[model samples]
Target chain A: MAADKDNGDQEMSGLLKSNFGRRDFLRTSAAAGAVALAAPARIGFAQGGPTINMQTWSAAVDTVQSHVNAFTEATGIPVNYGNAPWAQYRESMVTKFVGGAPLDMMWVSDAWLPEWAEAGWISPVDEFDFLMAYNAEAEDFCTNSMTYNGRQYGLTYYTDFMAFLYDESKIKEAGFDAPPATWEEVVEQSLVMKEKGISDYPMMLAMAQESWLIEFMSALVFSHGGRFVDDDGMAVMQEKDKGAVEALQWVVDAVNTHGIVSPACVETGELSGLKAFASGNHAFAMVAKYRLRMLNDPEQSQIAGNVKQAMMPKGPNGDHNTVGWMRFHGMASQAAQDKARAESTAKLIEWFGGKANGAYTFQKFLFLDIGAGFGVKPLFDDPEIRAAYDAYGNVDMIQAQQALAMKKDVVTPWFGEWNETNGSAWQSAILGNTDAATAVMKSAEFWDELKQDY
Target chain B: MRRLFGYEERSAAIFLAPVLAVLMGVAVFPILYSFYLSFFRIKLTRPNRTPFVGLDNYLDLFTNDLFWVSVARTVTFSVVSVAAILAISLLVSLLLNQNFRGRRVLSTILLVPWAIPYVANALMWKWIYDSGYGALNGILYQLDFIDKYMVWLGDQDKTIFLIANAFVWKEVPLATILLLVSLKAIPSDLYQAARVDGAGVWQRFIHVTLPAMKPGFMLVLIYETMMAIRHFDLFFILTEGGPGNASHVLSWHIYVETFRNLSFGSGAAMSYVLALVTFALSYTFIRSLGRKV
Candidate 1:
């Protein structure tokens, strides 16, 4: 009886699945239209006058709100500004885009440019000569990052690059007059620091598979003269001479052989790594250069006076290269369709990303409020911005490294798909589950497959 | 109105229309549409290019190595989590079943873990598992269990289990409540009869209590199995399917495919596969442990 009942149940489930027809599907699709009402209630629509709906990740909230208030007073164009937590921001924006929410403008990452552009979710800004004028004064890579295909998509919000940082006190205590200049020197110094009992893990890396993983990996790859994808968008990370293997192998040896890098590095994310580095526990780290502001602030860091930036170490065939990334103010494609809305959003984008009242007001203030790097070349000579950087950072080294910084080669429409696989493959190599070559090869293969799909 | 159809039926149809419409709109439609979408290549980014692909999505998943690995990880996580929750809940419920001082207070205290939000619980555990100054390290260090602080969640071998520990902590309270109700519903005469038959504490528990907790066990098992199989938030918060894909379970795979890769078709197919497995397990538990239909 029990056997008969189980068989009957299985049959029922099978029958249910098999019985679904095209008519039922059509009926369901029609019924599902009601779910559109369940979507989060949108803000007021701009019927009387143009209102720019802006979405940003919650960072510098007070600063952004004050700026929005000022813009409204100055332009008389009301703005609906909403923000989500930084970690979940992209997911939320993707949902809004897919659901046809009333989005006028949003912050777009360089990594998302290709995908967003291809999807028609965002519109290009090539026609806006007012916005385009800033491109000449902007850093070349920053402008390039904002452009997808042959058209410019937006104006730069901010740009920053990875920097190699070390605790100067620990380095001095370990009897090093200068920081390492190359990958080999890093391993040597790390081993010496480990043997001296100065630190347990002399080199700290946030290799945990998260959003920041690609940035960290890219910096290493670029400095080592390797590209995950070449200028022509073909995978070359698997090539032995391309410097990917050399960089990855060095890390593997540091963890398993030299014991300089903690095995737990695989699980450590950038946030945790920052805290650990600030706790005066490590001699070397690779982090965002903007973090220098926090590191040198006595209130936030234990090693406040000791933290210092260094040139990114070179590989055998590479130079002191690093990865640069930027976020920009973008117009929604739907909004851009309305010429009046387009003009208003373009003006708003210019207000924040370029200048306000004929001066780099937003850029100047943003740099002062947060140590976020600006793309405008003129702001580099600003007294307020200069003083802030000189307080905590070396302007010369920042400029030199920024010059060397390259946009990530792997940013394509298929980037999001390829990233997880690449991160995992690199991690597997670090864990000794696969050889470095095999991992690199597998990543390249996956990249090729994704590239094919696109 | 009675002449239109029948006296009672006409009135009933009129009254139920609103509720039935709502049910069709919200619940039935989504499931059917998702099923429909699973048969097509619906890339959300290229919203215009969704074409019918028949069984291609399912075939692709079945052949993919990552999908297989995710399946193994999902099975491992669900089995471990459900077993741990069941064992802990049973023990707690049995102890609570006894007449003891502050029983009510203890029961209320047991619900605290369950009361915490999923995001908050994951964040709390994240801090606890920090290799630097986390509570786990602090306590372990204080006890001289280890000479130095050791990585907890970051460690690949321990990532899934550590996540499971957090999951079990929250889940045990609800399971305990269910089992406690079963213990309460038992007649006092059952215990008296067992005593009359010279059954000792252990024997009576074996023959009477354990056997009687079947319905509760079925409920707990089915519920937890489904929860564990589809659990995403903790993995998302903790490892993010990281440390060399050590904790990349099926649910995370589905999310990455749908949300990250924008491959709604394959993601929907994977979700259906997970649903089928969950349903099969629930059915087996009900058949073995539930009261006869």
Candidate 2:
């Protein structure tokens, strides 16, 4: 009986071992099949190229998406585009960059370029072959705006400068056949327009706590033969030669003494001045050249077809200098750390902004579609582009003149801090809460502190 | 060695391991990291250079006038907005608790402001407060409230109040819902007993209803105060701490320090100060409530 039991146990153990071995073999085969199925797809993706990721604010979402789609179609490399609202864009970008997220390229404003490049947050593009294809005008502009410590970090995408957009009908009603030639003439014409009842608020100035005020003040100071920063790159607002105080005084007088500007100007944001001018409630507004399209659009502007652009009125110093704003596409240093990805991103930027394809570039399309001015000279001189802008009456010339009048070598790494401090000081002065001289002095002090911290 | 905990305790801990890990990653780690960062001088722009600054960031902030101004503004905003929210919420909850026509519909409708996205709500209020073409100016002019349109956001105090009102409009809904739930939880027999003792409407409310809703009131007070003190989006969109830093609060100041100034160390220090103040206030309220209860 014991021998019979031992034989049965041996049989059971052999059967169990055989079944386990068979199951293990089946499982191993299934795993190998799964790997075989997925390996080709993964390898294909790897060989295809690294996907490019770009970030910007909502303002550039449409332009970026369209250009990214075209680039992807031309090259099988996929691109990921992300955007946040303008208010959150700076913080979001900084967080993503500092968090070691995968950001390849981004649209940075001219004001932020200095700080970003100085801190080595962006990769220098001077060595890229595609950079050599930029036209002299575009290259000079980009180099002036994007160069930090003599190394280029960006490619110019779009350019906008502050200019005077006036109501032609109102100016004519006020007995002025031409735009004001000087600041004095501006005040005189504004008073005339007010007396004629053509506009309740003859001057629409955006004095809100935004960069608009800083841009306007910079233009004013530059036109007055003053600079925001000295040769040493220190804020020179308190310097007597820098007309910051006088320029700010003019802004305050426009609101308080002249009564030509609205008391609510302190609440006006970037677009509010343009809207106020477009609504036919103001005879003149100092705004960016980008407002040309909106001013000419019949749906958006009540004064459509009756508005015209001109260079900013000259200051007492007899200079026509204005504040130039440019937007650029910059490569992230982290993205450029990988040579292949860096090459791809450089190609994408060249396809977007370079003259390699001439009029076929994304920059040209952007200018034609939205009336945005290209940083490239040839595009600006193109007959089709000129005609497209001429439809808006001398817009092309006005933008060119504004570009020529841009203050040279004024931007500093502390541009953001300078803007905020000066904006608040000017806003307070405009609201009659503080004197212009005192405000400028206070802002200078704040700038000094900012410099110390940096 | 003998086991410190039995199998049941070990099993419970094993079951909670995932949640504990998540909390450590999200909450505990950030708090610890921020505290560590507060002792160093760091700038997001200058990522490669971070030097230990010890308590300089905190000392500098305490000496900074702008920091103090923001703290004062935040305190005032919290006090006024929380008071107004509590009053409006209590009244709404009392009204909703009573049987009325369309009570359910009204309760649901009250939540619309709170349901709307904060950005959208802020934009709406910005339009309403617009001086030139805003609905507020238009309606007030039509109603003959003023001879001319007033710039509501231009004045510093008016801007703060307008923001506070918008905040109350959004916050009162949740407060009302919580208080209403608390009101409902009170037995009807207690009200009957109060009525049998000849308690009038006001007396019944003070005697029985108030005592029952004390916990709910304390919760609303604590939550709303914290929310009001950290106000950022509305002020950012509406006034941007503007008309000369009149509407600036502690959170916006921290944002300026961290993002705009790129001074992460200073921002971290300010955050700790804000956290400490909030914790102190919350503890005080809870402790006082505990004594009362």
Specify the highest-DockQ model's number: 2
Lowest lDDT block of 10, candidate 2 chain B: B1-10
Tens-place lDDT per residue, model 1, A1-454, is: 9999999999988876899677887888777765665432322333324778999999888888898888888877789999999878777887889999989999999998888888899999989998998988988889889888889999989899999999998888889999999989998888788888999998889999888999999999989888888778999999987847777887888888888888878878998999889998789999999999999899999999788889999998899999999999999998899988888899899988988889888777778888788887888777777788888888878888888889988999889888999899989998889989999899899999988988
Give every candidate's TM-score on chain A: 0.88, 0.87
What is the lDDT of every predicted structure here? Answer: 0.89, 0.81
TM-scores, one per candidate? 0.90, 0.87
Error of 2 at A188 (Å): 1.9
What would the per-residue lDDT of candidate 2 be over residues A311-372, giving only the tens digit for each residue?
77777864776777678888998878999888888877776767534554767777776767
lDDT of 1 at B208: 90
**Residue pairs of candidate 1 with colliding backbone atoms:** none
The residue pairs in collision within model 2 are none
What's model 1's lDDT at A429? 91
